[model samples]
Target chain A: MTADPRDLVVRGLTKRYANGALANDRIDLHVHAGEVFGLLGPNGAGKTTLVKQIIGLLKPSAGSITLGREDFVANPDTARALCAYLPQGALPLSSFRLQEVVELVGRIRGGDAPAVRRRVDHLIAALELDEWRDTAGIELSGGTRRLAGFLMAAVWPAALVILDEPTNDVDPLRRRLLWRLIRQLAEDGSSVLLVTHNVLEAEQSVDRLAVIDKGRIVAMGTPSSLKAGDRQSLRLQLSLVPGVDPPAPPPFAHRPIRLGQRWHLGIDQSDAPEAIRWAQDRMAAGVAEEYVLGATTIEDLYIRLIGREDALDRAS
Target chain B: MNLFTRWLRSYGLMVTWELRSLRTVLPLAFVVQTMISSGLILGLGFLMHDITATQAQFLAVGVTVVSMITLGMVMAPQLIASQKQSGAYEYLLSLPVPRTTLIAAGLTVHSLIALPGAAVALLIAWLRYDIALSVSPIVIPAALLTLTTAASIGFALAHAIPNPMVTSLVTNVLIFVILFYAPINFPADRLPVWLASVHQVLPFGHSANLMRAGLTEGLASSVGVSFAVLGGWALASWSVTAWVVGRRA
Candidate 1:
């Protein structure tokens, strides 16, 4: 198949701030048309820097970013014209009513007035924000404001839609609606770049994802492909009693991760029974509050990847 | 659409957005501005028991200039700094509109908001002092230049400084300097010789001179020099603001 002109191709993209800090180090990635691509990384992992460059807010230190036949870095106007961005904070809507903000952005993005009004109306109804339509931004709740911001970006039709932490502060029901809207955007043939640290949500939403750590893509693949190595292992999670020290991992278990009162142990499938027995014994002894055995998830893989990078840095 | 049409459309939309966003605050801003301008005129009047006509004209026109300066130099910087702190400025930059249009829209809205207070101040000055002001067409360019220069400088300061708190502090200090220290309400001759020389280069004194020349004929000297100085400052400050706005990374 011929390459779609709307595909976002970034080759050897790098960004080094003036303070000699490297934010994005020779990153390369491709987001095909009509694809839901996730950039999953923890805060300060260069995800935002990458998005900023793509939207032409930051000049890349090196490499090229092309959306269709246009160069994004060299032609930032094209980037602005073709990309719809929902920045990762409360939008500056304090003085504006929700409906006004959405419709204004749509019109500014060059949508016909009536068409934009219709689109705004549709989105407001879809997200069930009609009650808050006339409410000023300052009066809206955080979740409602975020939903309005989403509508502002989604009201316009663009080749690429970049949403940074769009689900942040959103209620669960609205978040589900947002995810559906995101899927709808992709289905309508727009490339959707979902920049978020929520691995569980990204796993469910993205067609493919890249895990970034320390300004580099540590791993990139479909969710299942990235988790394939852990397929033979079961994640044994133990929630210990408060103030109790974590129990030691069994010989068959990999290094255990302690997060607050919870301990996650990776064990082979064959060793699941022994792991369960150990967990049960700990619970019986009151050392553990509860235990759950589940398949390895993308969050585990993300932590493992970041941990590996940390180890490599120490070695070097 | 052609580039011009596109720019005009974007400019119109941005102006609308800014006005709507400022709807609640605009009335309050107008009230505060009117109070400051009218208060200055009436309060300063009490200080001088026997004021001459020239001094009356000076204070009246001077306060009008101060009202214009306050919007651009004090309020604009504060607003922009707030927007920067809230990440709204960055969001605006990321939009699919020409950056110049945003600046233009801001200037337009601010001018609209400030002019009413200025006019009210002038009316109060006329009614209270009964000053015979010779209104001339030069007042138009003079007012425009003063507002634009002050706003450009404000925008430049806000954008150049990374910390919003610092920007706020600096603008507060600017308001203080403009109100008391600057040779705006009084003649430069009243200040020390060294300070008078300093006022020659600064835009504040020149802004007052321009307004005074337009409002009361024969009251302001060196009209040509005042125009040149204000224009130069406007150009320089606007250049800095444009660079900051258009810059990437």
Candidate 2:
């Protein structure tokens, strides 16, 4: 019987730098093919190190990385030929024009010059680098350079593409373009391993995510699945009738506001049913107004999984 | 494909780019230095009262050796140091290509830059000295040996220490010290015993001696031994350079 397509396996992946510090400690990861996997982490969570091992850049101290049963460590050249990596600090060669850089990398994929040229032109137009095709890398703006760097890797014919912070300096429009390109890649049956701290970006881009914290995976699942938490809350506001004082919200509610004789309640997602029943009872008691249910956003999950206070501290 | 062919392909590509870079930097220097050295050697020899064919040929060989040293010790190091600072080497390493190709390509370019100077020196020597120096069987091999040895030594030094200012200082000092013991325009008869003893071990003096022997007369056993010595130094330097670059990669 043939092996299944969902077959990336990493076991006991350990990496200790020469300075006696543990970067990755015996981590295990299994990523299915044709699926988008996001590596979410804080700045120094060893995300890049783990990605390096996966890309065959750095050797793990103790680990067995396999792609569909073939040993990646023992046959790195073959593994590398099958995958494309866009490193976090990737930059284009200053001497090469945008067209030249793209064409060169495309040629490395064993494509003929005409085919490579066609692909380069298509990518340039798709990425809106048409006007900058002849411009050197150093002369381009920071965001444009980043786009070029990303396109070079994405143009490869490899099965798996690993991108580190693809949208770091990209603006919203370019980010949309990049996402369209990524979705196209996934639709073409390629696996994309996205490493980024932009939870909002990852929220929309990845089919699934693995959140890493302090050199280990703290959580892993689809975006919706991971964000599905009991702590989800809805903020409901009720406008009181003329000349009537607003009533207090339930004990679970906090930050109740009285705006123009109105009442607001913060109720959890689970409490929504009971809270709605209570609201009906209050409405029968003549406390009247409309309310809004705020579904928990990915940003809220970001804070919950990491920590809100810690994020604020980091931002400060 | 075999490893050698793969490496050779990469080396050819890198060498082409390196030569393109040299066009802006040392190509002019090579032409000007060769002309100046050739003119000086011919003019000085012509001014001598009893300059014989052998002595003029000797002077030509001496000037050629000096030119090779200038290109190897000074120009090669400067070019490599600039490439490192410009992030060119890092760019090359980031490619799937081998590092040995990069070093070998650089050395090949260095040897190429030295060729014009040697050719000019030999032409002036043959013309002004009125010596019947042809492309002897020995001259081709001797020149190749000297070129290869200079390139390997220069490359090894550049790879070992890639700092532009430091490499310049060290190369100049090394060239000066090596010149003191080598037989250039000045006669080697007045040298001290200690210095003469040191000259026996140094490669420049031996290189000049071998080249002079090859052009003016047929190759003797002693010149053959000098050729062997130069070849040995070249082999060792190339080996060490490959090792260091491999380890760093």
Q: Give me the candidate number with maximum TM-score.
A: 1
Local accuracy of candidate 2 as per-residue lDDT tens digits, A1-316: 1334646778989888878778888788777677778988777889988877776666788888888767777765555667777777745356567787767666554456798898788888988879999987768877787788787777766677778888877777888998899888777777788888877778778888888877877788888887666346676656676766666677767555454555656577677787777777777788665555566555555555565323312110
TM-score for every candidate vs. truth?
Answer: 0.95, 0.67
For residues A1-316, could you state the per-residue lDDT of candidate 1 as single tens digits? 2479889999999999999999999999999999999998877899999999999999999999999899999999899999999999658999888998999999999899899999998898889888998998999999888888888889988999999988888888888898999999999999999998888888988999999988999999899999998989899989999987777777888967776677878999999889889999999989998999999988788877775323211000
For each candidate, the alpha-carbon lDDT, in order, equals: 0.88, 0.70
Candidate 2 lDDT: 0.70
Residue-level error in angstroms, candidate 2, position A214: 3.0
lDDT per residue, candidate 2, B23-51, as tens digits? 55566877776776776676776677688
RMSD of each: 3.4, 9.3
Kindly report, for each predicted structure in the order presented, the TM-score of its chain A compared with the true chain A: 0.93, 0.79
Lowest summed lDDT across 10 adjacent residues in model 1 chain B is found at B107-116
